[model samples]
Target: MPYYENAIKKMLPKTYLRQHVAHEIYVALTHFQSLVPMMDKYVYNDGTMKNLMSLTGTIPVMFEDNTYNIPVCLWIEESYPQTAPICYVRPTCEMTVLSGKYISSNGEVMLPYLEEWKNGECDLVSLLQVMVVVFGDFPPVYMHSHPEPEQAPCWLQFHRQAEVLSRTDGSLYLHLASEDDLPFQQENETSC
Candidate 1:
């Protein structure tokens, strides 16, 4: 049997066949538009009954006033519902290619909700919402105007290895790059 047919068949209790599981799957995919309000999820059903779909949506960027259009493909396995749908983020011009805690350079997203995906309770629309947030939080580093690696300023270089927090609450800037004192040196000691 094809993947979609198997997804609907194996997902439900063996005894409950007929139009129950298939009907639900059909309805969910067809009515996804109404579920997710923020992003527009366009689903394309492949011919036959593979249960495979290609979804595309525009997600707002968190870094600045910009948006990125991402292409997500859903592959339904035989153990779907019990197992979450395999989602992949495709490459796009609007998005800068980078990997982090939430996403990979290859466009793979690691969503906590997906791990806790509950059948009937959770749908693709909900998953898409989480996807949008994750994508937004981790914006493309390239989008920022960062100095070149070799010619980067001292503070910028330090920012990469360690945390360089910037705040504007009547802040006082401090730097300890002093040559007057050697680190862990005797108070009376002097350099010749």
Candidate 2:
């Protein structure tokens, strides 16, 4: 909590235009305990960089009676609530991005909730809930089955949705199952 408070204060200083932004961010973090706030330098495609505040971590997704944690990073703009946060699916080295209707090729999340966000009507918590629901239907990531030949590791196209479930006991387990015969895969990441 102190970490988030300090990061927000340092990264996004108080402003009359963004009076409620800090409080809103604090509330969202409190509700979504899995997400941890941090300040990082964000480099845009144009090569411009800016210090940005991001909530990075995983959110739980339930599938076939099991739960999986999906990694994500949300970058809050200075004018948040007035502007939608830039959201991305931050897949781990063991995971691969599954680009589809909800996720872009570069792992940016493209949801109707984000597209039609309204300042007063939309909130961070609600956006996350929408992500959970939408991702349940269309998962944004899958375990990378093969290791890269050149020393770096990283896709598969199938009708079936993939899931990576984490258990209390540590283990590296993966299940490639279809909807009718759906089994759980193990996620190696921990929640905040």
Q: Which digits, one per residue and each the tens of the lDDT, describe model 1 over residues 1-192?
A: 445545654444443432444554545455443221111243434634443333443443444566655555555444555667666665443335577876667666667887788887876656766776677776533433554555655454445332233437744333232232233333433322
How much is the lDDT of residue 166 in candidate 2?
A: 57
- Whole-model Cα lDDT of every candidate shown, in order: 0.51, 0.77
Best by lDDT: 2
- Best prediction by TM-score: 2
Worst 10 residues of 1 by lDDT: 33-42
| C-alpha RMSD values across all candidates | 17.2, 14.9
Model 1 scores a C-alpha lDDT of 0.51
Q: What is residue 147's positional error in candidate 1, in angstroms?
A: 18
In model 2, the Cα lDDT at residue 188 comes to 33
Report the C-alpha lDDT of model 2 over 1-192, residue by residue, as the tens digit.
466655555556454234366666677778778998777887778999977778899999876667789999998877777889999999987888999999999999999888998999998889999998888888899876767554422233244554455547755344456334645433533232
Clashes of each: 1, 1
